[model samples]
Target: MAVSPELEGLRRIVPSRFVSFSFPNPFLGGAPNPYGDSYAGECIRVAVLDSPLPAPSVPSTVAMLVPAGRHRDWIFSTRAGHLHLLLSSTHVSRFIILGPELSAPSPRVVSCVSRPEPDPAHARLLPLLLALCPAAAFLGNARHAVPDVPLLTFHDDLLRLAPVKVVAGPVVGEMVVEDVAIDCAPGPVELRRRLRFKRMPCLVQTQVRLCPSSAAAAAASSSLLEALDGSGGLLQPEVGGSLVEPYLQAMVAGLAVIAPSVDESIQSGVRPTCLCAGVGGGSLPMSIRVGLQFNVLGVEADSVVLDVARNHFGLVEDEFLRVHVGDAIQTIEEFSRQGEADMNFSAVMVDLDSSDAMCGVSAPPLEMTHANILLSAHTILHHHGVLILNVMPPPADVSFYQGLVDVLRQVFSELYEIDVGNGENYVLIATVSPIETRVTDNSGQFLTELRKLAGDFLEHIRKI
Candidate 1:
């Protein structure tokens, strides 16, 4: 495989920063499941919109997340097979149609952009246009690949394009088609829209504006998620969510380690201590896995998650493993305020909403977005303290990377990005400069150590 210079540089940086290892499952004694169930066999309807129409037909094997059923017109159900596009008018400018095919018994749905009809209103094709489904029911068994999906698009500009409203029908159970598209002209054009269908039940639909930045990010993030899934600790789907502790464990495993106790005597004029934030359930990621890693305190946002973490994840109320539940931001703020005594921390892990974007909302502005929550974590962490921002950074944005550099430059003396498993997702470590620096170039030493740790981590994971 060919390598990008940036990726090669990132690979070299990983071993120096993280000593990668498998996360040890805390639920060794057989307990309640954490992290909920994996979303599997869920069907969703997706409306792919652009200037030119994308492929007209969606593969039966493709798993689509369509809008909920309560909002709009009904679509006829068809087996997870070919998606038939019944355009509302002859003015359709362009559309692509894709067929589903089977390869490895597991359904593989492939779709492409195409110009199926010569109608002139491709621009007016409204939201809820195309639907998606898993090819399980259509193929008898799940298959991996779909064949001969052509890609086409309409480039010709059409004037006076009328808006077309698309809907999914419930009466059409799987393998039947009903009122899928309705013509609504000269109204506000919704860029993305969703409607629920009964045929493909148990699926949640989300429509996002895809851009170069997000597409790049999605590709990078997915690889990391896949890596986490493949690493031995992911709970087996059959074991009913056995993967939660393992996932938590991996977070712990990937954490930056703070040394034992030189800090008690010289720095802060206090005892050496470690802080772990977002302690959902009692699992301590680094401290527990590495054995007395630090005098650790666990913090969480919700009480219920704390309760669940403690009861389900086997994080007993040990004195060293102190667990606190409340608003993580507020808790950190209060900790920062309550004397200088409460503020010191060796490492902080912020995994607030899994990824940067909240799952349910639509087209929220990135400025006020919670995606940058790590900014808060940066404010409170102590010197030489490490902040682990759990985010999936896509490969395409120079600005996003620059933004992180900007933020970390504010707080830390040095920041390093470590990409685990083929440079997919990133774990950023912002380190505080050591106090009483003996070495001439201390920051460079920290960077060197950070890279060594990261590379060791990636190599360890690859071995597993």
Candidate 2:
């Protein structure tokens, strides 16, 4: 494909760096040791400015030639808790730069029409930042400024990658931008399947080590939530789509309600990270929990909405929560490329809308399903990871969702769907088996346990 003139101009101002990442699936989900070479590795070619390659530098603005049989993690540590990147390149591609300085020269925020709320469900700004300026890096110092929002900072001693885009202007397209690697493998696979064949939405999987008494736990009250909300109580829903506040509240409440069961059931503690799809201020409150944290990724249409999410909603607190303001499809791809393989989020909460059967026509189309999302989430989950999804009702024709269940059945030894309420939004949970072999749904232990945990809480979930 030819580069657009606008992109070319953008590239001049903001150069793009390309690096390849690859990984092997040997143990599937066991404690088998990963190939040593796979962990500490080197790139075959480090390309720069259409040229061959060179050594690493601060904010290293250079491309790398990744070899086969090697996963990207070998070169970049996407799982690092904290990262410090130094910009070494002066080529200034997009809003990112590869250099020794941890900070980019000065990032000019591309202004956009004020969005009442950005999609806190899926933080799109991060991906868009990479899309617009692959060279952009976090002005490390500025990170502290946003205390309320949880941020994920990646440190690549050999490099720094940041995203920048021109938000406005008649020549907006002319703005120089850089490119970043975006994995689209599953997209093609997803598009090939029929609506009935589409897989389920992707969910971060976890194991529910529940306490025998978990079912006896009391439901968390909205009053506890009031404490979290401070004097404001539950703020009225914003005019546009500020789902962040309410969503966060419910998410936090849900975790609080379930954590006791999780702790009681399993000796190992649960550190959850949920994924959902939608644009609203609803997820901020969910970002707060004594033991549980979140990565509320949402997919909304507008960029300004993200600004609203950050500005209006109190989403700027910690690094655990982030908003990816973009189409759900593209946002997932970006995460995959960023090394989701090494990520083991405790839980994945999928609230994305699957096919709509109201019109009798499958919305996602039987051939083009969201199964890829499930497959990807499966790859990202930890051992015995639990997967939770917000499901629609039957007769509404959620064959697509069913297809996901069928696929999960093949891998998961146990699966259960509880009527969190009698509506389209039901909490569907799947527990991945440590061993790859399939397990029968016999004995109903899974459901038995799920009901115990859900109990009265089921009623509250429905109301939300």
Cα lDDT listed for each candidate? 0.33, 0.32
lDDT of 2 by residue, 170-223 (tens): 211111111112123453211000011111211111101111112222122232
Error of 1 at 272 (Å): 3.9
lDDT of 1 at 436: 37
The estimated TM-scores of all candidates read 0.40, 0.35
Query: Model 1, 1-464: lDDT tens per residue?
Result: 21223222221111112111111222123322121121111222222211112222322111121111211222212221112221211222222221111111221111111223312222222111211121222243245332221223222211111112223223222211111111123642211111122333212121111111244443553432232222222211111111222223334434333332223322445544556655533434323422433466766654644443343234456555577756565566566556364566666665443212112111111331232444445455665666655444332233564565576667566555544443324555555653233221223323233333233442232110
Cα RMSD to native, each candidate?
Answer: 22.1, 24.3
- Candidate number with greatest lDDT: 1
Clashes of 1: 75
Q: Evaluate residue 229 in candidate 1 and report its C-alpha lDDT on the 0 to 100 scale.
A: 22
